[model samples]
Target: MVSGTGPETVPEAEFRSYYGHPVIKRPIWHVPHMPLYLYLGGLSGASSLTAVLAGLTGRHRLARAARITAALGASTGSAFLIAELGRPARFLNMLRVFKPTSPMSVGSWILAAQGGLSAAAAVSDVTGILPAVGDAAALATVVTGPLTATYTAVLVADTAVPAWHAGYRELPFLFAGSALASAGAAGMLATPRAEAGPARAVALLGAAVETAAATLLEQRLGLVGEPYRQGRAGLLLRVARALTAGGGLLTLLAGRSRVATAASGLALTAGALCTRFGVLEAGRASAADPKYTVVPQRERVETAGPASVPGR
Candidate 1:
């Protein structure tokens, strides 16, 4: 009879912090470099995958172009990543130890492997140097390609960024779809229209997947998703959505004319770039707002009890 309240009826304890500062560290990645690296990595990965698929299906020219695209993208993306580190000499330190628990380490290894394979494949195509070896190298990318397309999602989600972590499940799919669209756009741009049929199909499918994942991410993320629809991030995502949708629609008629194909390809490529920038902006916005960090933590405590509360 001494009880003041039942367990289920207990009032939620108010959560407070030191002047509403973010409880977690914000990402230290610089603008343009990190986001651009993500976009390029995705494009490289998907291009490698597409190259392998095209080669298997007897589209030699398209496959050659895709291999070169993958090589160029991966090489350029690695340069961006190295620049982000701020010290080219320190790049080797990233490979000192393999830690399965470290997404960065995993990604570094994947990038290294991808760069080598893609370069080898591209060179082989250009010089007819070790043709079978080049083909095998291209095929090897089939394994690393999907990982490259998706691991960046895990990298971002593993961080404390509220928007990124909250959308972890959808982020991988989003990035994968974007990667496909990017690679497809490159393929369509570089190859003859007659040989671009698979590229068109891939682009459309990718656009659909990307659009669906983005919509779901925005809808299901609740307050955490707000950053995606406000200010610069919002503008970028909105534009990306429109471009992706429009580009996908245009893909149906792209095979009919070079102008249509080029237009659709350009739209999809721009849209993919916008998506990466928008996602990065959203993460930055979430980190900038203390509420995004505090509120979600408070909710977890309320639902699971204080013992389960994460240490700030």
Candidate 2:
């Protein structure tokens, strides 16, 4: 409290935490592994959705490419996740009980189901076996695919990290857009240019959505969003935005050119990866800074008034 002649004349308290330490512990999720998992999980989820849609529309080559991408992404992503857990059993242990209220639990289940279904679809596509079962599996992924793409956003948003928690409204859309862009990139890369028109369209749409969501998140978050606009996180996100924008334009003008398609696909893939890494870095930065945690809380208390404050 400020020393003043009267209460009304006192200045507001400056924000501080004990001994300059962070008010909340920084997330222990390791670099590369966690971000890679996030990217690959989104890729797998969106690829599955693309595969199902392409198949329904008679784009067999595109569908096959998406199926393969979905299977590989899911399997590889799960490996990264298991490695992060330090044990495969730890990954399996999460499936012992279903908890609807737990985003991690729900995400684990979605990942498992998506992985299995995508793998089945890919195998059937490659081997020309179990066509009926493959169709069923591919169709089932429609239910799990969108959930898998966006659930990680929920998982992170549930945490206390100001960057993640405060942007909950926009994070899911951001992740979903990134996921779609990733899958579309994979489809474009794997399928022939002539057969990849829909993939290009998806990539363009995803880029638009991703860019809009990211802009809104930063704008709406105000001070809490500083981490995303400064430091390593800012650099990465800027690169992501540039790459995604360039890739989207390339896809728009690709015009049956294999080189342009490949270039756009590669750019989009890199942008999506950068987005995941940047988001993680922003969350870490926010968690490490005391101001991000304290300012909003103080503002909330002040807005609610002394009568509503706890322990008053």
Best by the TM-score measure: 2
Model 1, TM vs. native: 0.91
Per-candidate local distance difference test: 0.91, 0.93
Could you tell me which residue pairs clash in candidate 2? none
Q: After superposition, which runs of candidate 2 have C-alpha atoms over 4 Å from their true positions?
A: 1-15, 308-312
Which runs in model 1 stand beyond 4 Å of their true positions? 1-21, 305-312
Model 1 — which ten-residue stretch has the worst lDDT? 1-10
Lowest summed lDDT window (length 10), candidate 2: 1-10
Tell me the RMSD of model 2 versus the true structure: 3.4
Per-residue CA lDDT of model 2 for 243-283, tens digit only, reads 99999999988887889889999999999999999999999
The alpha-carbon deviation from the true structure for residue 125 of candidate 2, after best TM-score superposition, in angstroms, is 1.1
> What are the per-model numbers of colliding residue pairs?
0, 0
